[model samples]
Target: MWFSRGLGSLNGVITIDGLVKRRGKTEILSGVGFQALPGRVTGFLGPNGAGKSSTLRILLGLDRAQQGTALVNGVPFVSLADPVRTVGAVLDGSGAHRSRTGRAHLRWVARSAGLPLSRIDEVLELVGLADAGSKRVGRYSLGMGRRLALATALLGDPPVLVLDEPLNGLDPEGIRFIRTFLRERAESGRTVLLSSHLMGELAETVDDVVVIDRGRIVAQGTLAEVTGAHRSLEEAFFALVSR
Candidate 1:
């Protein structure tokens, strides 16, 4: 049940165009647009309530936009023929039942996606959860739960990964692991799009950067371009979004 490292011919492009989302009279996103190309890690950076999660939600089809499109490859996520095999997403934690063991939770997901049960072990080990697979999810710590969520995302070995605040609960070691892993994925020609407020960590991981604030995109480009004339990405981010 070994999955290939990369989908050689598969295109893993994420196109977000003119995304506009409104809740009652307040707009959550305003004409947001960006492209996450394959073979690169794209960091979606913003402050809290800056529309980062909202944009990702629309991209993953968990939420709708009022006047824009979020497409993976050539079509929307909801229209993908084999979604589980096309895009792996990590959002809202593990989404696992409290009573289920980590392995059991992965087993259910594998079954639902028609993936081989053997993949469960592979992903568990990949996420460094091999020893904790038998632990009940409810008893796991926040970092452990995040790892399980990552394991679940890798189950299908999708070419595109969309994650929101992926570094939320990770420790230093876990952060290092994820940063290296994501870089490897991008080097292997996969698409990695992640939203996080940890600018220092993201500066090391992302090849491209997109900055959003107050539901609008204020800056976007290669890491160097976005960090132009700034001491670091953190400085650049604050300079861009500070109002």
Candidate 2:
């Protein structure tokens, strides 16, 4: 995909084109193209092996694509001079040290970024972890861990947020909180790209969507444009991907 730096006045514009990835002889993605505009919660939807994780990894610069490009904020994520303030992500938080306190973990990240210590508590509270801020990560439930990961992502107050399965292990309340939070973030002129396999959730939470299947874009447009409310998102998704 090619972007001309003419993405209007959007604070962040993510462009991907011909994104190809191969693991050995098996092709993971082929010619995927899409654009995520700022100020909207763009849902990234796909089947179990539709290369969503691969795409997110490539976008975050954690993995390289064999072909094409993924640009964040009009530049490749890897080429960004300062990524912390440009983009924030929470792909997986299982890597965090289980024995460490949530506050300590956030403090470490802040220290690495040369950011002030107070920002840690602010983000922790922002993600609804204020009461459990001092608890060790191991003691926290999966929902709490997800909240902690969200806190980490919000630490930099980045303009773009890329989250994978953010509602993975959350309860109804947690999911509701995240839905509201993401909506508010977009209202604040930030960009949010959320990947999920849950079509029902996506239908309720997203303003726009990019649906992928077999590593290819099957549909891209506003929720109404992609899934006529008469046809549920799941119905539309299955019809598109199954083809």
Candidate 3:
């Protein structure tokens, strides 16, 4: 998190408005919209096939939408002059080639972005991969691979983070590490948009919640507001999506 430290000044608000997407004849996202304000951790919650991934893909500029926009600081992701310096994203899978060493993979990214080589060591240690950075990515365990992928994302020191299923494939300890890491980043004033199906986990970490179901947002507000009359976030999530 050191690389993204003190990024408050650069932090930007994340706005998703009326986004509509389609896959062949089926509609995947139907006028979805929300916000992850700067300096707060916002959880994007939805059941499977809830259009969470589709929304994230549009926001990260990984895919285009038929209508609406996902804006970072009031601009589209692809329109940014240097996206790496402004936003760091960690989507599904470790996103690292099995053939390259962890350190080598990071170095390549740093070089491509014109970032200094020293940032590599900093992020490696930040994600607790200093010792294994030299090992081949193929040999790393799932947890280690996820850490490396996170380290790669942090290398750019982006002020905004859009993470999709970051807790996937992690053991209990690994989950705790990432949970704490994300909270600390948000506490430090970085805008964080975390997408996951884990309601209990998000209840402990997010300041705000945005619940989506079947391509549309069912609710969006602070944890308590979103939870409504439910005993916990999980129960509230079930109620919202079950309808």
State which candidate has the highest lDDT.
1
C-alpha RMSD values across all candidates = 2.6, 3.6, 2.8
Q: Give candidate 3 misplaced runs (Cα > 4 Å).
A: 1-11
Report residue 173 deviation for candidate 1 (angstroms). Answer: 0.4
TM-score of each: 0.95, 0.93, 0.94
Error of 3 at 127 (Å): 0.8
User: Which has the higher lDDT value, candidate number 1 or candidate number 3?
Assistant: 1
Task: Give the range where candidate 3 is weakest over 10 consecutive residues by summed lDDT.
Answer: 2-11
The candidates, ranked best first by TM-score, are: 1, 3, 2
Q: Can you write out model 1's per-residue Cα lDDT over 1-243, one digit (the tens) per residue?
A: 112434333378899999999999999999999999988999999999999999999999999998999998768899988888889999967779989999999998899889999999999999999999999999999999999999988999998899999999889998999899999999988899999877987898999999999999999999999999999999999999966
Task: Give the residue spans of candidate 2 off by over 4 A.
Answer: 1-10
Q: TM-score: which is higher, 1 or 2?
A: 1
Q: What is the per-residue lDDT of model 2 for residues 65-173, given as tens digits with 9 covering 90 to 100?
A: 9999999866799888667767889886534689999999998888877788999989987988899888899999998898888888888788889999898998999
Candidate-wise lDDT, in order: 0.91, 0.86, 0.88
Please report how far candidate 2 places residue 138 from its true position, in Å. Answer: 1.6
